[model samples]
Target: MNITINTTVLPHLDPDESVAFYRDSLGFEVRSDVGSGTMRWIVVGPAAQPETSVLLAPPAADPGVTDEERRVIREMMAKGTYGWLLLAADDLDDTFQAVSAAGAEVVQEPTEQPYGARDCAFRDPAGNMIRIQERR
Candidate 1:
């Protein structure tokens, strides 16, 4: 079986705010925005390639999630200990500058990683870190 990773839970999310960040700042397009409630699913990707979309899922309040779980999750986020969502970009500096101009909280200035990617990071309104990566 050929497999590829696609979706994951995304938090600290206001759809409008996130959309603005992705579209205006990063040049992604809204590929899909479907339904509401449990049926909801939104996908966005670079305008250059809409097929490779990122799923913007909300914080989990699914059947098994509970008060303790939610509390722990919120606290982790509040402490800024969450993992980042790395997005592809044509130019790291341009992406960084755009996001900064949009008033995103820049957590780190653009830098080259040992992995050979140039990137910069910020925290979304919901406290989730987002990174713009220009792959080598």
Candidate 2:
């Protein structure tokens, strides 16, 4: 048996901004884009890895989410605590410089973590934490 992650979902407050961030800042390609305005759902992934993708969807669109829960989610997202992604690159410094130059909100400059990995972090347009580590 084999298993792999095909897609992951992240909530977005604005579709266009999210698309720009993932496409321009992180250098991911927009695989698919549907709907319009706040109701949009976008699929994006690395240009080289067509099998893996991230889905940017509207928050609180599920019928199962209560109003109170939606409010809490919005608050957490605004605080940059709700959603996160862990990525990797061959050249950490170059990736960091490119992302930072593209105007991403830097949470941490590339540093050698005590955990024995070199990594950096940023916040996406919707405030999702994006941590990129050096690929071993």
Clash tally, candidates in order? 1, 0
The best candidate in terms of lDDT:
2
In terms of lDDT, model 1 sits at 0.72
Model 2: CA > 4 A from native: none
lDDT of 1 by residue, 1-136 (tens): 9776555456635677766766776667888777665444568776666346677666664769998987888777766675458776777787778889988888989988887878888887667778778855
User: Top TM-score: which candidate number?
Assistant: 2
- TM-score of decoy 2: 0.97
Please give each candidate's TM-score: 0.77, 0.97
Backbone clash total, candidate 2: 0
Taking the tens digit of each residue's C-alpha lDDT, what string does model 2 give over 58-115?
9989899999999999999988899999999999999999999999999999999999
